[model samples]
Target: MDSPNTLAVRIEPMTVDDLPQVLEIERVAFPSPWSARAYEYELRYNDMAHYFVAWLDAWALRHPANDGVIGWLRRWVRPAPTVGAPLMVGYVGYWLMAGEAHVSTIAVRPEHRGHSYGELLLAHTLQDAARHGAHVATLEVRVSNTAAQQLYLKYGFDKVGMRKAYYSDNDEDALIMTTPPLNSGQYQEKLRRLQIALTMQLNTQMGRKLSLVSRTGA
Candidate 1:
């Protein structure tokens, strides 16, 4: 198994082409996975929805052991970008309404759950929301999901309310969480610092071998 240290993280807009992998992840990550039709609707028709996938291209990180002249050339010459599919380890989705960004879903493959990748996804979502002029962010999580609640709290979200029997599948109550104004200088500065810390964490974990690319254009 490749270490989390070997991960090359890339976040891009989710596409129909990515559905198979994303569906697999969705199944493994959640007990009640979203249907393919629903994902298709979001990707193809929803205008206010923004979705992203976290890709781990370990091949690049695993192939840096060559030496000598060929190695020198390889080091200096960037590999031609290949049109290959990526390994989808996680995904997130949110809906932008008025000036609020509402997180609809977030998940990571079971094998990839413990390495702070969820936080990375949430961070990117918040950052994207801020970029799009969103004043605040919100989400609803299962009342029993303490791990997720902790992550939200760490990112400045607070428990605002609850929806009784919000989950149709099990009639579970949902805890609503909301963050303070994201456009404020204090919040932005906090995000900036967290982004820097994530960069350093990834660098230290990979021994400086990987780059974290989280682009919002998609």
Candidate 2:
């Protein structure tokens, strides 16, 4: 059952058209964001890269701003050209190589942070990876990010090793985490249980319910 406030959210392949909003999120989410050129290369040339964007369908019309500068602008631009479409909220990127899926980056908008959106993105990525013939999924996180580490642990990722001074900006160590074979029954069952729990959490905390839909077939 979906909550009344639930929004239609979908994850789709990242296209060049999505870079504008994706860049905005990238700038705010990371201390060292990837350059637009880098993203362009991945989208255009890197066959191994699979990036996705999460969109809140018809979000603008459903929650219109009737007051403030944004409202005034909306009035000024009467008969707004764009309406009734999904607005990109967050993104996830991964590279599939040699039977492994490496999660390069994932982030949600700052204002949209506390709603279990990140978990949703991660779950989608892992499921997508499994469907695409990946045996394992892995990622690296700043050692100091315990909250994120905890979330990864909850998703069946384990700290297998550490990288020395992996972060360029602060020269911080990164914790290397990897999941067991995603195609295995054990891992799939674990993911299924987590997905069920996540659905409950998002429904309760965000006033909105959502579900995962895999493009490549999960």
Candidate 3:
């Protein structure tokens, strides 16, 4: 429940228009973040890269009590309208080459952390990657980030190797994590169950339904 924080989120392929908000979260999420140009190249020219963004649905976040008769009356008694586009709460990107997909980056906005939004992004993006033909998935996380390691492990990733001084900002070694062949029956069952659990968890906090959605990369 992440401290009873109600949330509703959508996952979609990152469009060029999402960069502004993406960068806003990126700047504070890492010690040495990728520059705008870097993201631009990935979205615009990198054919192997597939990226997705998670939006916090403003309409979904509105109080459920503001509905039907109560909502209709509230409009006249105390009018408050849900407006504007859903905001980008986080993003995840990965590069797929041959049969391998490498999780490049993932982050959530500071205020939106601890709600499993990062896990949502990771799970959805990884599913997308598999759908697009990723046989295996891999990622590198800071050795000190036990939290991230735990999450990866929960998703069937295991520590396979390491790269010394992987983070330029801190010279911290990175633990290389990789998942089993994504098409394995065991993995399929695991992913299916986890996704179902995630949906139930999300709806529990959302106060409403927020279904998963994705799009093909350009």
TM-score of each predicted structure versus truth: 0.82, 0.84, 0.84
Which pairs clash in the backbone of model 2? none
Q: Which of 2 and 3 is the better model by lDDT?
A: 2
Total clashes for model 3: 0
The model with the greater TM-score, 1 or 3, is 3
Could you give candidate 2's per-residue lDDT for residues 1-218 as a string of tens digits? 32336656778889898999899899999999988899999999998999998876554334433357876776576433265655677999999999999999999987567667788889989999999999999999999999999999999999999999999999999999999999999999999998899888766664455544545422
Candidate 1 CA-lDDT value: 0.82
Candidate 3 RMSD computed on C-alpha atoms after optimal superposition onto the true structure: 6.8
lDDT, candidate 3, at 28: 89
**Residue 18 deviation, candidate 2, in Å?**
0.4
Clash tally, candidates in order? 0, 0, 0
Q: So what's the TM-score on candidate 3?
A: 0.84
Go through the candidates in order and give each one's C-alpha lDDT. 0.82, 0.82, 0.81
Cα lDDT of model 1 by residue, 75-133, tens digit: 46643224343567789999999999999999887745666778889999999999998
